[model samples]
Target: MKHKRLFSEIKADLTKVEKELDKLLAVDDPILSKTCVYLLQAGGKRMRPGFTLLSGRFFNYDFKKILPVAMAIELIHMATLVHDDVVDASLTRRGRPTLAAGWGNTVSVATGDFLFAKALEMIGKIDDPGVAKILADVSVEMCQGEIQQIWSAFDVKQNFKQYYYRIRRKTALLIGLSCRLGAMVSDGSLRHMWLLETYGHCLGIAFQIIDDILDIIADPDEMGKPVGGDIRQGIMTLPMIYALQSSGHRERLGQLLALKNKKEAQVQEVIHMIKNSDGIERSRTVVDKYINKALKHLEELPKIPAKKALRELAVFVGERSY
Candidate 1:
């Protein structure tokens, strides 16, 4: 069997899809349009859009139709990031100054809202009420997830279950929804839709788990942002939670949390402690579970090139070091 990375095999299609994303996001107003385009230009893995296209392959395989949905999905994602900067008080994304950093909170928030409105408008043109509803509902869940994260921030007393729920809503919901919507757009069977939806959900959870892991393990240059960012913000992730709960470092973690200084040296120590402790291993195991669950969904899909590509994507998520 010939093996090719999904994106590499579909390079031409992906390129056109990216161009459509650029076109849809173009705006006339200098400030709002520029800020909106800035974040898109900053670059992302474009995984959401990738999933959108891959899932669509199961049905109509129309890049023209799929591109708008992909752009809308990305816009929804970028909007959340802009708002997230304000909520996290973050200054940088992908190592560049964030909208909140240069434009101030009000402008950033309004820009996010504008992008969201644009996404909704695009969805309205899709002509599939079911697709429209799914996208709209997932947007709600995404917002709710953000609100939940804020509510749970710095609350070390929270458990793994609460942490899982937060990530699922905030991160996984859209990914799963993207797959589901894509499958719907392609006119895929209900069984395929269910499988793809589940696959996207598991992959999304794994993605977020990797994100948390990289916070401690990845180099700042590679990550395009500082490590220990979540720690500096006092938000505890799975690895941190596992380290605190499973290891005997609970007291130490508590002490670090109580500190007001939070110097770079101290934050590095906390990161080192989390890394060297059982936290990274435990977090890796958690990711493995999601990866396995994702693979199980793939088993039901017909054996084909796209299915093989998706399987590799899942393993790539769990096994990727950076």
Candidate 2:
């Protein structure tokens, strides 16, 4: 099934969330307003909000309560992207110029901070301290993950455990929280909440792995960023890690990665080497494993349309190319 179709059940709720995001992001300053609007217009899969709304459907299905959470989750995600572009020095995203590209790092950082503060404001309306704490803790962990990535940049010696640790915080935790929050606000049983959170965590891992794979193989136009952007920035992803560990060209790959300022030819050479290695295949295998695990968690949940949607979402995550 096409990815957009997977969220059909929650389409209306997501629409409401999108509208709320527009209102929430409105600011008086013309520059900040334009930047916020541009960020919103850039568009994304809205997966975090989709996960929240889908998980909620299994319980009370209260849109009134769930909408704020969904909007806040998306806002947090947008904030991260804005800040990430600054950190990565990325010029484009989703086939458009990034906030940093247009307004420079200072404005981008401030915009990110503004979005984060707005997210917190939205979360505050929930009246659940547990909810606030969960989001806060995850936000802190995400920052830590970014720091760890920065420290480990161009360091080929990093191990599997470190990679998992960074990704869990960087990507998995928020997704897990999205599922957990949906269940919690909708009065789901503890067991159901656990199941959904675990499902989301596994799917999140698979999602990031596929993203890492796409960074090498996806068409730049489709991917909305340059191919090999991760490697160019000295950030090591699963494919590169796998190649360094087992590929015959590890020595040459390592030397190229170690370079602080790589030419386009060198970046393309590294991409060529990784594509020929087992790294891409190995990463796909890992993604399949996590997708399987995510599916297993859904099996124990009650049979419902939401359950089926979540299952399909897991499959989509494993196979998505862009």
Candidate 3:
């Protein structure tokens, strides 16, 4: 399997990352430590950190210097997940009860805050205001994205531009930061850093689009939630947006979404309506576009093993289901 192959190639470094993450999460309060560990252990591809590590490799930078930045990127990602679960009222993630589900919202939120603080501490060790400013800007964009998400919920009138920028703020900015900062810390050329940032941004947005598709079609066990989860939550993802715009069932979908609380059958109806339309295929088309954009950025970079691995990583991003 490519999964095993990928891990085998990066095993030693990833092990270091895992240990660093665990050490960083250890805290004074047992409850805080336990909750943070629980969330971190919830299985994920760790793709953000993986991208950071790969970008760092372009300069063949010291792994020790890169580790703190890579770890900080991952910590930010995990922090977002914890807060996201509470915001979405998600009960399960990766088939385990969420921090919000196992503990309460307050505890979950506090744990997320702790993670953010720790991430900032790691950034502090770098001792660069420029780097701190980058994270600060991304953090502001992320909060704005969350606000936009709440306002855009169940919104049928939303256009392509609105959805595009929302996902950029929510996912792409930090991903771009990871790659750019990886290069920055590696002392990469400005041209190389910006190119990597662009690559990361395109890849991250595509990743989110695929995630939404998986939320519709992937197995519950694999997806960590039931199908139609977004539909039930009234989040208008790309598939749903396309369906609302083009599917003949738009009226019925609109009617269903009008309800303050959509029932199980109604959510199912919307899901199938989306699948039966051009939504899934069209959404894939958009994913492909972003991926192509990423590949173009890679084209400008020097031919190196890390660059090849990044290309493979881009393919993996598109093919990955969970």
User: Backbone collision count in every prediction?
Assistant: 0, 0, 0
Q: Compared with the true structure, what per-residue lDDT tens digits does model 1 show for residues 1-322?
A: 1223555645677778677767777878889678867877887777788787788877778877777788788878988899999998898888898889989999998988988898887887787787788888888888888888787766777688888888998899899878887788888899999999999999999999998999889988977788888888777789888888766667888678545559888898788788778989988998999999999998988776777778888988888644
* Cα error of candidate 1 at position 40, Å: 2.2
Instruction: Give the distance in Å from residue 177's predicted Cα in candidate 1 to where it truly belongs.
Output: 1.4
lDDT of 2 by residue, 208-298 (tens): 8888899999999878888888888888899999999887889999999878789999999999999999999999999989999999999
Stretches off by above 4 angstroms in model 1 are 1-5, 258-261
Taken over the whole model, the C-alpha lDDT of each candidate is: 0.82, 0.90, 0.83
Candidate RMSDs in order: 2.5, 1.2, 1.6
lDDT of 3: 0.83
Instruction: Give lDDT tens digits, candidate 3, residues 1-322.
Output: 4643454445578778888888888787979878977876775777677777778888867787888888888888888889988998988888888899999899999988989998888888775677778887888898888889888887877778888788998898998888998888888999999999999999989988998899888888867677777787777788878888888978987777655588788778877888898988899999999999999999989887778888887888888643
Residues forming the 10-long window of minimal summed lDDT in candidate 1 = 1-10
What residue pairs clash in candidate 2, if any at all? none
Ranking by TM-score: 2, 3, 1
Q: Which ranking of candidates, highest lDDT first?
A: 2, 3, 1
Question: Which consecutive 10 residues in model 2 have the weakest lDDT in total?
Answer: 313-322
Which scores greater on TM-score, model 1 or model 2? 2
